[model samples]
Target: MAGAALAGLRIVVSAGPTYEDIDPVRFIGNRSSGKMGFAIAAAAARRGADVVLVAGPVALPTPDGVHRVDVRSAAQMHDAVFAQLPADIYIAAAAVADFTPRQVAPGKIKKRDGEDGLTLELVRTRDILAEVAVDPRRPRLLVGFAAETGDVETYARGKLAKKKLDLIAANRVGVEGSGFESDDNALAVYWNGGERALGPAPKTELAERLLDLVAERLRA
Candidate 1:
């Protein structure tokens, strides 16, 4: 990190939660704060990597020396990521919505009297990570993130294989002081046959550690 460890590398990172709109004023989203991906971009740029961040709707400022493309929905993020790709590394840290409303109402959905509940038909959003894994322009090191409430490693490993990713960082989401909207996080990183535990520390430190692992993987 003190030198240009990632020099000459092109990296793409995605962060934050995709908002799947239900109506003009309502949407389905998650708790991701975009801190982790931004930190990664910052650290990578500091290490002399050309970084492009495809970010979701988050209030955080763009990291210095990093190019950013802001997006609101999952589909836009997918397009933005691919546009910047053929990168040396791709880190998918965004918590994209699994489902979106099949049809979006053009106007604000109004509550009707005596209608206590409303139902919405939803459809699966494109699996951006899975698509990236199979893309001809896929990066050399494809990394993903899994935020889970239970069986973290088990789920993370499953996703790694399912998405054919080179590495994955998994963390528990329901815990206090870590994961989603918190400044700190802990990650268990897994590859084909190896894994490492990192943090319970600040996200900035975690990002540096994560990049260190990425550099080591690139060397191998």
Candidate 2:
């Protein structure tokens, strides 16, 4: 692969898991360790692209030469990405929660002695990728992740069209040691005219391969 294939390009990437607060002491979140997105950011920077990484809560060190913005919630992630928009590429790798508590409790709720059960109302979160895809200043290439367990290709293709993304990276979630919070990953990439399998390698190798494919698409 040419090291300068993505030279001078600007890339924006979102990584990690968004937290939705239920109370001051409790929140809803996923198990994304942010390894994949961080790997992508590092790969893009290595390819000489200016990278802006909008990250959620994670312990990964900042990749050399990549600007990172840390955020906690899905809404914050969405805002951060758009604030630094107009990039050449946008990759939505964060495992964003689909719903959040309708209202965050001011304080922890006390358990009722006689109550048999409790119910909580939830609301759909803003579809960050969909929002960004429809923006007038959206990036030239938009990539989304469809973390599905079954019917991988069908769901990925659907998301590609529904989100109006240039490409979608599909992976199986909920399998034993396969998806969320895993260090090694495999991807089935789908686009308008083609699809390809990426890997079961280390995150860094997969990132490099994915970047190469992105560069090829951009050049074409």
Candidate 3:
């Protein structure tokens, strides 16, 4: 592993769905299983980079040979990631919530007998990826993920430029057997001057190929 392509590099990654608490029990979240990010971490570790994974609430076991930091809400994830600054690469694969409850209830709010609906004020959460994009402590290679339903390349490239990422893996969700919690996925990886399509493959294999590209870029 010492002489591997990513040898001696420092890699930081974020994975899973961030939960925004509405109460002690109830929360806002998505369907991210964290397989992609975990796979990436494991792959990078095998390639000899020191890996630190900032993860959201998920049941997946920590990958062998990697450092794992567990977190719950989007804000906590942001803090955890910033704490691992000065890495060679940072991959933000988590599907973090954009907003969170403005005021969390101290306890569960019981439904009123006659109330037609409930309104909970919400506010924007920290943009972890974009935060790393601007920080002087930012990694040399920053990667992001964009899940879209249409015009995948256009949207992904937009995010690449807007978020100041070195790469973005764009995938269309709602397909028959890919995206979200699926073990299999397809990706069109976009960078500033070029792009590459990684056809549908298991999360593990996809992670290997994606990391191969990152290793190439870093060497260049």
Computed on alpha carbons, the lDDT of every model, listed in order, comes to 0.94, 0.91, 0.92
Residue 99 lDDT in model 3?
A: 98
**What's the CA error at residue 81 for candidate 3, in Å?**
0.2
Q: Which consecutive 10 residues in model 2 have the weakest lDDT in total? A: 174-183
1 against 3, candidate with superior lDDT: 1
Ordered from best to worst TM-score, the candidate numbers read 1, 3, 2
The digit string of per-residue lDDT tens for model 3 on 105-159 reads: 9999899999999999999998989999999998999999999999999999999
Please give the range of 10 consecutive residues that has the lowest summed lDDT in model 1.
1-10
lDDT of 1: 0.94
* Best prediction by TM-score: 1
- TM-scores, all candidates, are 0.98, 0.97, 0.97
The candidate that wins on lDDT is 1
* Model 3: colliding residue pairs: none
Off by over 4 Å in 3: 1-3
Query: All candidates: CA RMSD in angstroms?
Result: 1.1, 1.1, 1.5
